[model samples]
Target: MSYGTSFNYETILICLVAEVLNLLTTFIFYQVLKIPLFFDTIFIVAVVFYLGFVPAICVSIGYSLINSFMWICKTGFFDPFIPMYGLCGILIVFSTWLFAKNKSDFRISVSITLLYLFLIALTSSMCSIISGGLIDYFHYKYYEVTDMMNPIKNFSEGFIIQHYPPIVSYILAQIPVSFLDRLIATFTGFGIYRSFDFFMKRR
Candidate 1:
């Protein structure tokens, strides 16, 4: 929520790097591999651990906006809904900052870090479901994907057809996938942050 009163090229550089890495991660996982998981938030989470809340949130927003722009360029149509998922990244940053800000070293212990990562995964998954539900309601109310290739989407549809609420269905279907996705992202991001911090301290 607050960045100390300072402006520096190094901060700018860090944000730029995080933004690009987030974009590339998204592209590789969601586009090239056609994976259902969104690995894009890895660098954003890393930024939160490296810098703080403000820089990480800025990177998240920048990544979302750039992603939307790229989608427009590729499809020749803008999907406003694409950027709305930035909320997921913001939630992840806030959750991570809340957990790590109190610790002096932020290393804590492996067990504690794993617990925090699991909570983050749960939190991010719920946030994503809510955000996605809202976007669907406003933008794609009657939308239906006929040939859903993603297993999560396919599973979600099973619940939807059973007269369960779409939002609930989405939450149930995505929790497992999102939980695993976020666990990997936060774990890897934390490792990257620790490595970078170690090298910088040695310098």
Candidate 2:
């Protein structure tokens, strides 16, 4: 294989490792801590601090890959779903990082987390809409409701005239998820730091 081939292989390996790590972290948070969705922000933040951009990028890419694979295996390799999952991960991580960086005090952190959750939900909803649209395109069928449009359709025709408002509402709904994630991150970070300190003191 040429250098390009080697690089491609390496990229795939990295993506696989990242996917495994992402799943492992999510599982631990869900099973051990009994919380999911909320702690994802915390995990991403921790990864950012410990491993920086590489890990963040890998996490996003890995998430996309795993989700895409699942979609493919379950529903046959649909093209729109691939971009939908992949792009959503990237956007979520990017938005989360932006909010995390702006956080200063506890209040700020909370606010940021809430904002982050809102943005995530909105982006996710949009992605879902895009995914649905793609499905409709490929299948040549009209969807009565896309993810972002469902609530509006259910409520009234003019309930949400544009996609952006629904995204905002979705993000607001994710506030609790963000709060839970932050709480878990704090406890986990303190526990690990204290353990390290105790061992260092003895040494």
TM-score of each: 0.85, 0.42
Question: What is the C-alpha lDDT profile of model 1 across 178-198, one tens digit per residue?
Answer: 677778888888888878889
Off by over 4 Å in 1: 1-5, 137-139, 142-152
Backbone clashes for every candidate come to 0, 1
TM-score of 2: 0.42
Q: Give the deviation of candidate 1 from the true structure as CA RMSD.
A: 2.7
Error of 1 at 67 (Å): 1.0
Candidate 2 segments exceeding 4 Å error: 1-18, 27-43, 77-88, 95-172, 178-203
Task: Give the Cα lDDT of each candidate.
Answer: 0.72, 0.45
Candidate 2 residue-wise lDDT, 93-198, digit = tens: 5544453333242244666645554554455344434443334333223323343312213232232344445544344433444344444543453344335446
lDDT for 69 in candidate 1 is: 84
